[model samples]
Target: MKRRAFFLKAGLAGLVVGNQGLTSCAPGPKLYGDKNFYINKGYQAIPKLKLSKDRIIKETVGLRPFRESGPRVEKEMLNNKTIVHNYGHGGSGWSLSWGTGNQARNLVKTTDAKKVALLGCGTVGIATATLLQESGYDVTIYAKDVPPNVTSNLATGTWSPSSRVCAEEKATPEIKANWEDACRFSFRRMQMSLGLNDIIDWGDEYTVRKQKPSGSNISGGHEMFHIDGLNPEWKTLAQKDHPFKADYVRRRSNMIFNIPSYLNFHLNNFLIRGGKLVIKDIKSLEDIDALSEKVVVNCMGLGAKAIFNDEELYPISGQLSCLVPQTEINYKLATDGAYFITRKDGIYLGGSGIERSWDTTPNRQLTEKWVDVLSDLMKDMKG
Candidate 1:
């Protein structure tokens, strides 16, 4: 069949064909499934994604604060003040926030200081602050940006505790152990937030590929943690059982966050519990020394690079283009170079991973490329 005709048959490009093309064809009876009708008997038709320039809601870019040695969750003494370091989570900030917060809270609990100062109001900072408040410590958060403007808001909003968290060579025994604890704790904490104003929920994700993935292509880092059952079990689907135009499809369920709502919920919870937030930027070590609290938890993310002289900290730029929401499309799809996830806000399309790039400007070309990739994948879709 011709490419255009195939698209038209699949109900994907009738608008491009125009009214003239429709008028040219004589009216006939609509055909139903024939020989292969039984093949799709119980299968639900995958809803076609309305991919177009007009459907796009917005394009956003975020810089993941990557560290080669993984997240630094330890305490340091500086100028008579105890600075508990809890930053550089990279792409795993949201996924591992609760676990890391617990680690930071433990460090603070050991200190005699009853009042704690938190730097940066991003996910990590908020989580740490709330945890400390719950533990009976008076907490004050000082940050340059919050909520909609924070880098955490630009995340893809999926559970990926190890994504760019650390390099392969840096995943030592101690780091792996700490990572496992965080993953397990975060997974349990995330479960407690499910159904709370839809801030977090579980959804199936389909990883489609043109060919079967080889052993080397499969990631084994998650296994190294030894946190069994933390994530949903993966199941390989038969070609006829799935809807993607791919030779292999593996499906698994994972937790996803409605970032805006989640942040708001936590921020509100903190405020209700008497936690204070002050809008301020800590530019240098002098700024840190000016804080009244003797115990300070630094969750500055990438901003820690200059303030703390963390040469290991760098940014991994990622872009996401969101489209109008479709209520029926609840699952997530991940192809070779792009991924699409359905959320209450919009249908997020993402896949750009530019390392050590500090630029947060959305790339138009990259957005177009992702659209093209999704369009091509759905061309052969049945529905």
Candidate 2:
């Protein structure tokens, strides 16, 4: 089948596409008590996102490993081998990789083994292995798949530490405290990696709303465990200060990752540091026992649901429709249940969280919905 026909048949024809310029909408008349009056200083015009089916490069699906009680960072003994559990970060796997890696490293410190085997090569596994290597442990990563194929590659690549990390009722005081530590540590680590081959950097994100926000907008039970400073505060923009057509526009600076570059950099770094990567499928505990290393850190993400029999672990499926990279559209935008983030590889449009879903198949209807939402917003912007 032809690429264009395939996309059109998959419902890409619903997308509104054109050269829509992002001129600012006219501001309301100034009033003495009005705080939303147009301001010129610090105002920057946003460029229109040229969203089209023709620009779409690919669509991907990822199953986020969600556990009701939050991530498992504890340790246990399996077949006399030290097994440190470090999986289940839900949608925040990439965002909280380093912090969880630190927790896993601490667990390994209790063991006498200098060589460690890491299961899975996703964000968590790679991050944990890299930390272990830096801490003087010879590490070998065993995984069924690597980057560009792993679940982490399908991530939106935004820094959202608490998104679907745990259920609100399960977020006990102890969990909140531990999560705060992880979030803070991870945020610092992400900031430290800025400007290194453009793997990570800060980008402005705008959240447009048709009505004024009356309460917290944080979703996926994140508001209960919101970490101050680590979670950047959103500043509500005045009508004339932004280009969005919505009544309420809020902006915040957040860390964004170029997944391909970021993963490649870490993977290459691990290889250079004498880290071994074995392509192996671990089906059961006995498979891990067959390894030479006595200490194993399980960073299998959703795979832990079967291997470790974690009843609380399940999948929260998400999908991303990637378009050709737009150099002018550097900033991210979120509105009407859809978001757009421009990375070096592509401009990713995504926003779907279906809990308890193990299906990794990309939904054409959902893809069309996202494109419709984003293209509608773009078309409303003045030319």
Candidate 3:
């Protein structure tokens, strides 16, 4: 998940294919496409991906709990018990999972209670439980559904926090510090987590452009926020260095988590480590307080709209169409609205964010539209 939608808003141009030519291949950022020159090696992907209606193994939707004010990570008392909220990262849910989980765990520490209840078993819920358990607390996850079945599985699973996290003007200065902390912690965890068939790895990402997008970094309905440890500059890439048929190209190193495997790893780890999971559809906030754990952490994502009655939180509906996996397709390419990434599970082609659209049913027409856009971009490659 290169977060093209957010990058387009930030007007972030190329940075992946260094400042040198494709032939020299130095380590520094460079661009070289003034001539019609084309290098022939290390620049080819298995062209002509088979993205068809029949090839679509599964189509899932996730309603990003987007809030104009930013994610909820505060605590309040209800029914003589403490309930800590930790939801609403919008498209950055998977990316910010561990960091936000740590943030929630920090809140849990203020209370002397050692037993905690986690609501929702998606990325955030699971992460929160793992952290709490590691901190020597008795933890149980209460959710209507678990991973491989939750909305978290549908996430593109890219490490991009500023991807619709919040508007700069709307976010308080403290939220920015929190974002940095969460990002740094999560990045370190990803580096130390299971890798090489475990669904977490470093991958190359390309942000291809037809022309420089119109907007300053923070203007034009877009936002450009910086993370402390990550590189903000996108180096230019000549057309000869990359495969896409775009006028300008930028590249960067990105951390990627294959959703299906990543979720499975977390769930299995939590269970094997003595964490308990209870499958119960909570009917109300009072229902949570009735649970055995004294402290309840709400990680309900979009469900909070009804569960907690927070009107500011809304769904940013997103859908991803996946093709059969091609292991050689290791990198990702993102244009205006469409993006492509390949993982062990499948080659992913996506996506669209329709505000307030909660339809989980995959639209064949929308899928086809993205497929066509990606196909046309790759149609020029020789491989």
Q: Relative to the true structure, how large is the alpha-carbon lDDT of every model?
A: 0.85, 0.84, 0.77
Candidate 1 lDDT over 264-286, as tens digits, reads 99999999989999999889999
Clashing pairs in 1: none
Q: For candidate 2, what is the lDDT?
A: 0.84
The list of candidate 3 runs beyond 4 A from truth reads: 1-39, 42-54, 194-196, 217-224, 228-233
Q: What is the number of residue pairs that collide in model 1?
A: 0
Find the candidate with the highest TM-score and give its number.
1
For every candidate in turn, the CA RMSD to the true structure comes to 11.5, 14.2, 14.2
For model 1, give the 10-residue run with minimal summed lDDT. 34-43
Count clashes in each candidate, considering only residues at least 3 apart in sequence or on different chains: 0, 0, 13
For residues 185-265, could you state the per-residue lDDT of candidate 3 as single tens digits?
877777778554667877777777777676565111133357644644566877667656677778877777888888888
lDDT of 2 by residue, 322-372 (tens): 988878677888886788888889999888888888788888788788888
Candidate 1 wrong stretches, greater than 4 Å: 1-45, 215-226
Residue 304's lDDT within candidate 1 is 93
lDDT score of residue 78 within candidate 1 = 95
* TM-score for each candidate, following the candidate numbering: 0.87, 0.87, 0.84
